[model samples]
Target: MRPLKRLVEQFLESEAKGGILLFVTALAAFVLSNSPWAQAYFDLRDVYLKLQVGDWVLKKTLLHFVNDFLMALFFLLVGLELKREILQGELKNPRQAGLAVAAALGGMVTPALIYTAFNYGGEGAAGWGVPMATDIAFALGVLSLLGKRVPLSLKVFLTALAIVDDLGAVLVIALFYTSQLNVTALLVAALVFGFALLLGALRVRSLTVYMLVGLVLWYYVLLSGVHATIAGVLLAFAIPIGRARPLPPHADGVAEDPELHEAQLELLEDAAREAQSPLHRLEHLLHPYVAYFIMPVFAFFNAGVALEGAQVGSIALGIFFGLLLGKPLGILLFSYLAVRLGIARLPSGVGWGAIAGVGLVAGVGFTMALFIAGLAFDAALLDEAKLGVLSASVTAAVLGSLLLWKTAAPRPS
Candidate 1:
């Protein structure tokens, strides 16, 4: 338990630093997009890339490789984090998880509904899922700016909420954004998934073996037209949650010798440490790469929307208002209802106003929103949606920071 707690703490600390880097990279991207080097930026993203093995070949632009292949790694990390939280982190307790769950649901539903009201039965209706995401890195980055003005409990609450929000986004992508299905490929993916599970059941702790099978699964799922990122999530669940088993008091020949008992216990501890599941190891190893490298590169590629001829029409307006207005409104309203109904209680040292402020911060839905926009709209409408996401994310970050700074109590001197 202490080890798990330490791992979570390390995760948050790295995330805070990563958030700063993400901001810097996004800013650089925006600058490059609007400057004289814009054509070079676009050209770099459009460069064709291909992989061939024998007669089989896969081809895509550089940007698609980033979006499809690299982002799948990002989602793989997300899935591992979600699994860890559910198994032993904050979400392990029902009461502790209730507030985040309710807040995430409201955050997702209200944004979708608000977007739908504007684009219902229209071409942009498919984009209702765009504003439903919360960029955890950006939101936490903003929160970290406040120093100790915010409580640790509040930060944990926000983190949990964002994780739940991510889960919702994953579901939406799997259910709504998927293209045509290929049954044969899906069966192949299933067979690979089953083999991975069998490895876990057999307690094969070699990460190399699991990863090899996972790559096969990812390829099959990619061919199945089910949005290949789902394969990452599926692979995550197959990884064993190997908790350390306690050493029995009367093991082997320790009954008559106290020193031998202590020696045996130490050996057991060492074995237990080594027995930690691949999920934890992979999550730890990949988190830094995902945060510092993959995400910043992703932002550089995806967030460079040209503002010269960009028009903010109804689609953009819907996304803007959905993120800016609908996010906070739904989060605060549902949270209040949950508290009043005794479904969940606020964290200690946190007030309704702070929660409202956090809700506003959750509206900084940049990365995931941009990714969904790519899926939800054509090239023409994609620019409009990106503009809305960029504008709303900035507004939400500013407003939420102000609200929290003004309302939060100062730390004890």
Candidate 2:
């Protein structure tokens, strides 16, 4: 139990550090883009790369590769986290989950409405999805800096809210952002995804089998005119999280038989390893890589467009106001409505002040916002989109962090 607790602490610490690294990398990329060497940066971003495996080939620009391939991996991790949370984590409790679920829904809808209002029936209207995301890494990273000033309940609330927000974004991308679908490719992907689910239902435990099957699934999904990242989520849902049982606690005393005690410890550790679900295992294995590498790379590559010649239309205004104003308003209003209607209550040790602060934190939609913007807008409008994302992210981070800093009291001396 102690070791598990320690591991959770270490994981959060590592994630916080990773988020900081992502921010720094993004800042560097943004600076380089606007600098005199902007042409070189743009050239590298636009440079095409190719990979071939026998009869099949994949060729895309450096930016496309990062956004499609790497971000798919990022979404895979997100999907795994979502699964675990729904099954055993904060989302498992119906009452506690209600607040977050409602808040996340409001957060997503409000941002889209705000963006739509500004760009209605215009060329930028498609970008309504731009501000609908909440980057959990960036938001949680800010909370980590507050230490015990923030309550664990508030953090848990935020985590659950972010997970729901991610699921919403995934649906929006799949339903609204897809292109002309290829029927044959769609059929193939559906069949593969179904087979993968059958394998999970049969309790297949070999990681290699799942990965191989997942590669095929990804290929078909990518070819089916759906965003490639949705493949990651579908694969995640297909992976089995086998049933887990709690181990019996040992009596707290010196053992009469030393050898027996040592054996029990070994057996317990082995049980612990085997008891973990494939979903949990994959999530643990992939989180660090996603945090430290994939996300940072995606941010650097996707968020570096020059701001000088940007198309500063209603699209920019829509995104900025959506994130800065709409996110908090939606979250706060919906949450209170839920409470008033007897749907959910505030978590223990949390107040409306903390919820408000968390609402602002939810506005830090950096990585996902940029990714969706890339999908929503074409090259002509990308620079403006990136500008709005970058500016809103920074401003939200400052406001959210400050609000939470004041709302959450410091640890007792």
Candidate 3:
């Protein structure tokens, strides 16, 4: 429990920093794209990259590499977090998880319906999945800015809700976004994926083995017309987490004995690390990279939608309204119904206003929304969708943060 608590704190702090960095990168990219160097900015995204292994070759632009390859790591991190929550964190208990689970369902369905309502029978209709996501880092970053003014319960609720939302987004990508399939490639991917899962059941703790299997699974999935990124999630489940044990209150183990030798302290430190599950170790290892490097680079490439001559059409409007209005409406409505029907209850220190505020924050769908927009729309409609996501994300952040700040009850000093 002590280790888990530390991990949670680390996650929150890392996200705050990462969210700020993402803002800076996205702004810089946007400015470059719309400035005199617009051509160069777009060209950078189009820079072709290639890798070959004998008869097998993989080639994609810089944008595709970031989106396809780097983003697989992002999803891997997401999968790890999702697994932790389901196994032992907030989602472990159905009683405690009911409210967040219900709210996440509402968050997903309402936005998709709202987007579909506006773009029904239109070219943009396929992009309904764009608004049905929550950028947890950005949302949690806002809460971090507010400091102790907000209850800890609110943060927990938001985290749980966003994770459930992530799972929904994963499903959407796997089911709806796939294109024409190559049966042979899919069959191979499936068999490889099953073998990886079997490793976990066999209690194999070798990270190297799982990773080797994952690479093969990824290539086959990519060739099968299924998104390769989904392999990240599958790999996550395949990695075996060793037995769980709570670390000491002080990691050094020297805290309790000031006279201990330096060599003894070093041994204690090593023992502490060994006690952690592979999931925890891997998650900690990847957190810094995902937050500081991969995600910001992804933002630089994907968020740079040229604003000049960009027409705001049904796609933009649908995403905007779906994120702004539909997100809050669905969350609040479902949460209220759940509580009223005795299916769920509000957190100890939370109220209707906080719930509403959280629903708005969940509308900060910048990362996943942009990723889905790329999948659902081509060059012609992609810019418009990006515009909608950017505008809605900023609006939701400001509005949600202010509401949470104002409505929060004063806590004891």
All candidates: CA RMSD in angstroms?
A: 4.1, 2.5, 2.0
Write down the worst ten-residue block by lDDT for model 2. Answer: 246-255
Q: What is the TM-score of each candidate against the true structure?
A: 0.92, 0.93, 0.95
Runs of candidate 2 with Cα error greater than 4 angstroms are: 1-11, 243-267, 410-413
Candidate 1 ranges beyond 4 A from true positions: 1-6, 244-273, 410-413
Candidate 3 structure quality by residue, lDDT tens digits, 5-42? 78677777788789888888988988998999999999
State the C-alpha lDDT per candidate. Answer: 0.87, 0.86, 0.88
Which residue pairs overlap in candidate 2's backbone?
none
Pairs clashing within candidate 1:
none
Q: Whole-model lDDT for model 2 versus the true structure?
A: 0.86
lDDT of 1 by residue, 350-411 (tens): 88889989999999999899989998999889989999998999999999999999776654
Q: What local lDDT does model 3 show for residue 179?
A: 92
Q: For model 3, which pairs clash?
A: none
Worst 10 residues of 1 by lDDT: 246-255
lDDT tens readout by residue for model 2, 1-413: 56544655665677678779889999889899999998898899889999999998989999888888888888888888789789877788887788989999999999999999999999999999989999988888888988888876787788889989999999999998999998899999999999999999987877778889888888898899999889899989988887455554662333569878887777777777677778878888888899999999988888787767677779989999899888999999999999999989998777787788889888889998998998898889888988888888888888988998887664354
